[model samples]
Target: MNAPEAVNETDAALLAHAQRLTAQAGRPAPKALTRLAGGRNNQVYRLEADDGPLVLKRYFTDARDSRDRLGAEWSFISHAWSRGIRAVPEPLACDRAEQAGLYSFIEGRKLTAAELTPGHVEAAIEFVLAVNARPRPALAPGSEACFSLAEHIATVERRVARLATLDSEVPHVAEARQLVSAQLQPTWAAVKAGILSGASAEGLALDAAISADQNCLSPSDFGFHNALIDDAGKLTFLDFEYAGRDDPAKLVSDFFCQPEVPVPLAVHEHFIERLTQGLGLDAASVARCRLLLDAYQIKWTCIILNDFLPLGAARRAFADTGAWAERCAAQLAKAEAKLELVGADDTP
Candidate 1:
């Protein structure tokens, strides 16, 4: 679908406002401008100013907490940069009042479904492995807690429960409830068991603990569409709106969730190998991480079935209830296959 039209703001007005903000930061206004890709959620544009080629990202709605969002993004991009991850754009300035920001625009093609071939997956995997190598910095003093898969599960459960109570005749609502009920329990059990058995639980005592320590930051929305690849084949990650502290397994699950890319079992194995090697994780830990990845993938699939897919053509495409159930069943079957392999290898 095409992006919603952005509000008409004149170049002169935007430039003047941008100039004032840049001046405050000891920089100059952009010399030229061009509208970039606009998405359903945000308006992105390119600013060719005296300073250099920069990007302007403007929010279409005020529902978001722009201040905290920008702060989190800035922290993530800066931290990832320091750790030698070349998957982020450089943030130059932010104006929370205007709900806009300026950043260094990397030259590259926006990765599409077709472009995410085997080679692209390998490169993207390496980039993420590098980014997840270090611990995420503490959220800014007053910022919100970083996003979490466990928290997301809780939210989905609540939403699904609410949907169940609503009138049963609502299209896909009943099917959504059935899907969540059938899938959530076993999936969450696998994740919990994996975490408890892994080395990451030695110090953490929480019932739903995914990691003993939250050391890595994950782009909660990591996908091919959010990646930009340059001529040199280097990938740069963008869209930090959902960036937050998370377990590495969740990040891997996010990558595998891309509908266009069929991530084979070998891809998963290679990803874990690279990740653990890069992060210096032990073999046992990697095994446990594999199980957790499977669990997270199931949970993520349930989320898509319940929320985004229920209201649109996704429902018809998958067939109302039976097809949706089959999809979840298929995911669980694949997950079980992977888990079986993990279990077999872990056997003494």
Candidate 2:
């Protein structure tokens, strides 16, 4: 079931390191290596062993936005597993020195919209709620949430400003500039003031308004986009490099915000109704979720333009195909749609 593939010195070293660590964990050394797809921040491969199938992830540091990638992932998942959450890949071994980790491979396919049945949608909602039910896990020493509300509007506003620093003459940059300055900045000032006057840095005054817990730990990116489902219909989630304690509002808003895998409004309605009534969340929390969603919507608008950056273009090998502008323009279009969609949604 393994494919024959070639790897160079860097990957060879990573595989050798994983072998030693897996052996230390009482697992067999990897006998074959086949690079798998669907990763933006790591080199993911199928490591064939006597047990036969496992996943090996090597952090891509050159262009990644996260810090302490391996440490944060290891700590976050370990804490999640310890909390009785279910259906995630089991960690087999981790080597921080090499910035690599091994996990048990799940036999499943990533579910696209066509393959995502109603049952799958229901299960996905349940899984997110369960994650929220668990206590927040500690961030790795040097790690933090992408947009935890504790940092408030100032944090993401600074990131938006950074996107303009390059002043690159790229179409993606032009579109992003238009969106962030013409639209996001003008709207954000008012929203920020409204939110600040309403609550403290911690978050909305949910405690005073309702008995519900404010925000639960998030996988940073929440969606079925990073998940798989087996023949038996079980869901196995993946990707936690950005996982940590996060703002509750971002959690709710991001569930259906991804550009690649869009969620239906009916599904959103079901998810919102369940979380609100089931968790006993108050209106204050709803307002906060809406506020953060507005900010994250703009944040993602800028992120789509990241691939046009100098280092990012090189890391993704855009020069090899020479379609960097095409890709950036496409991402810009997606960002525009995302802005319109989030702006139109009046839920809360």
- Which has the greatest TM-score? 2
* Model 1 segments more than 4 A misplaced: 1-13, 24-27, 31-34, 38-40, 59-67, 83-85, 117-119, 132-136, 139-156, 162-214, 260-265, 282-288, 298-348
RMSD (Cα, Å) of model 1: 7.8
lDDT by residue (82-135, candidate 1, tens digit) is: 787656887777887777777777888766654556787777677766666645
Candidate 2 per-residue C-alpha lDDT over 1-348 given as tens digits, one digit per residue, 9 for 90 to 100: 122245442567667876887797789898767776556546777877897778888875653454677876777677767778766887878888778888888788767776667787777767767765644554533233433344646556776676655447555676667766776566667656656666665455423422225545667677787787788888887877777665555666667666566666446556666777655556665566655655666666656656656656654552133456787778777766766764455443
Against the true structure, candidate 1 has what lDDT?
0.56
Worst 10 residues of 1 by lDDT: 339-348
Clashes of each: 5, 1
Name the runs in model 2 displaced over 4 angstroms.
1-11, 62-66, 114-118, 132-150, 167-213, 277-282, 314-323, 346-348
